[model samples]
Target: MNFLDGILFALFAEADKSAPLMVPDSVQKANFAETVRKLANLDVDQLLQNLLSESVWILIKVLIALAIYFVGRWIVRRIIHLLDAVCERRRVDVSLRSFLRNTVRVVFTLLLVLIVVSTLGVNVTSLIAVFSAATLAIGMALSGTAQNFAGGVMILLMKPYRIGDYISAQGQSGTVREIKLFSTVITTVDNQTIYIPNNSIATAIIDNYSTADVRRVDWTVGISYGDDVDTARRTILGMLAADPRVLREPAEPVVWVSALADSSVNLTVRVWTKNTDFWDVFFEYNERFYKELPAAGINFPFPQMDVHVKNE
Candidate 1:
């Protein structure tokens, strides 16, 4: 007992001994002894016997509660597995799988917690009400996060680009490395990494270069005004044709007299090739055109100013 309780009990014992009823020393000692001695008396023993009778009921309650918790946990796991299987069966978007899995796991854990609390005789309806109120407050506090989450959900549901697709969006152009609910990861051509938030990505104009099987390579060639325009056109077309990477199925390369200036005529050349061969073919054709056109007696135009000699 605490010191205060000990002093109070001793004072009470002394007062009892001085009472006119005149209780004996032996009886007073029994009444004032430690709680352990008091509990060992016959009356206390009978009270304990009554409590032991109800102990079995408490054990049963504990076992039932434990069983509910364990079984509920098992059910939660099964639900998660079922969700994963459903996604696989429907060929659902992979970017959303991780998000859905985490959400489902948290929800199931919460449900299990609620069920266990209910089994232990907690007032679950009130608990739910309290949790809902708290959740509403939290939602208000993190409204920006809610908007991002909504955008993320939309991005996952409607995939604009998949992993490894070369894309340009939100002022960044790169090959998509990974797509998550919150952000889209991109690795640029120069190997620089960039992350675009889902909210911005969803609203921006996305240029997906990897979508098309073929990409057109565009280049402009300037020719001297005096050179044979017909010869230049034929030579450029021939170079495009000789390259196996160029797509002949789309017809021969288109060469047009796009622009005419005082010094030169600009010819625009467009060639179509498989996306994989785009860079290789474009570089090869540029080098070939620059080297071969001159050898073929076709003049490449350069800036020139004619200086008239003044005769005095």
Candidate 2:
């Protein structure tokens, strides 16, 4: 046999020369209690041989377990790399690729651990039972975390928004920077970072501004009531037409008298432009309307009170 086995055999041969160990009559009759009692009566030579034999078997088992673990790790890495290549060929989203890779790694690693434990002679069935019970208890205690995790999966699948998309949800609006397993990170217009739980975002009303190629910009321009409505409309339309960023095919820019308030007549102007140019067109046109309308002899309205004194 091997070196360790040969050594053990030699030791056992020497131990056999000692006075033959007494066998209890109950043990001969296959009584478990008598077998246990006979174990206490084992001579020093017999006990030493038994301990060495068991220890050698355990060491061999440990070596085999270590070999499996190391080989399994190498195989796991190759599998994950192949998975990444497949995902890339399928054109998966960057966030989704990360999630899938991590999930596969965890599942494979857990299976490897189980295999190693089984090699060590652990009872797989009892271990699974204990694991299941512990998992149930933890799930009950961390319900919110579990919900968030589920929500993350939903977000990745449903794709309500993606990284770099500007979205407004749960009373927070920002450009998404990352979509993690539990939360989404966004950077606000003012450059503030916000972490929103995926659960809340999934259930909230999401306004994804980046979904559409073009968006409508609306502004209300108020002029003095006496100002000519036709002139004001023409002036606003001219300004819209002058801006190259404004879209003209699907929708044409239009202005209408929306409200005749106490001080002014409000003209609502609506125009379509590329999403990227929405804010630029709105802010620039606001200043343009202020300067161009007044220059066109249309005065802005101001609050005024009429007073008449009656002398008795």
Best by TM-score: 2
lDDT of 2 at 61: 98
Against the hidden reference, what TM-scores do the models get? 0.63, 0.70
For candidate 1, write residues 213-243 as lDDT tens digits: 9888999888888888899988888877777
The list of candidate 2 runs beyond 4 A from truth reads 1-78, 112-125, 303-312
Question: Highest lDDT, which number?
Answer: 2
Candidate 1 error regions (>4 Å): 1-90, 96-135, 304-312
Error of 2 at 204 (Å): 1.3
User: How much is 177 displaced in model 1, in angstroms?
Assistant: 2.8
Q: Quick one: how many clashes does candidate 1 have?
A: 0
Please list the C-alpha lDDT of all candidates, in the order they appear.
Answer: 0.80, 0.87
lDDT of 1 at 24: 86
TM-score of 1: 0.63
Scored against the true structure, residue 187 in model 1 reaches a CA lDDT of 98
